[model samples]
Target: MEKTAFYTVKQIPPEETYPVRHPVLRTGLPLATCEFDGDDAPTTFHIGVYIEGKLAGVVTILENAHSRFDEERQFQLRGMAVLEEFQKQGLGQVLVREAEKEVERRGGYFMWMNARKVAVRFYEKLGYIIDGDEFIIETVGPHYVMCKKWK
Candidate 1:
């Protein structure tokens, strides 16, 4: 899909991300389940991609370390989602790149996430590497720990 000038990406409050999260990531689950840990922490931040002034995608970043990473400064990327109509149009990539920039600005050396199995390739395309075996999170189905270290 061709890029559009109407698309914009920026930092937004964590709450602003919940709408997309609930529908895309937590379908059939309680909206509260879409709220992630450290979402309100001072060191955490959310990014939203807007198309024509309407938010079409969102991602949250937390200052948390993955057990397999030794970096003292790490950010966990979570609750990333784009509206179904916006999927495959490059909005997810825009959201991720925005989150990575924020993590780097915050002095983080690495960024990790429990990426859903189906979305693994999406993360890989953005330079994230799988770190361990895939596992299920009770209600969340299969996921793999993926990480990207700034070089």
Candidate 2:
């Protein structure tokens, strides 16, 4: 049961880049805080998943293109998570395919997120789709605005 590798911040290490403050990755956000903004092109990126070494799993990607749709430019996969005894062992689909291969290697095509309606069937089985409807993220509760496309 050893298969989970993906690091960026200098190949990770410094206590596994411990800055985890994820409350369901801040669910939908409103009252929660801790959103870094800077890196012009880097909307957001932070994935950590160490098995034998610990750290379990963590995520934080927010590549906003106007937060949600504004005509071309999007990638807001907020704070995914997996630490409840490393649930199911899949490691949240390897931290979302390494954050969709770093959002398609930075070219950015499309990859949104805001699913919290009970995880929305685990992001539609890792293919994400649902869009619009079901809102109320003010206090970070119900949500839905999933999207996917890496081509």
Question: Model 1 segments beyond 4 Å from truth?
Answer: 1-4
Per-model root-mean-square deviation over C-alphas: 2.6, 14.4
What do the candidate models score in CA lDDT, each in turn? 0.88, 0.64
User: What tens digits encode model 2's per-residue C-alpha lDDT throughout 1-151?
Assistant: 2252532221232223334434444534443353444322334567677766667676666667644566376777766666666678777787787777877887877888777898899889988888789887765678988888767
Candidate topping lDDT? 1
Q: For candidate 1, write residues 4-66 as lDDT tens digits.
A: 696988888888988899889999999899878799999998888889889899999999877
List the candidates' TM-scores in order. 0.95, 0.29
Residue 58 displacement (Å), model 1: 0.2
Q: Candidate 2: where are CA atoms >4 Å away?
A: 1-43, 49-52, 66-75, 86-112, 119-132, 135-143, 146-151
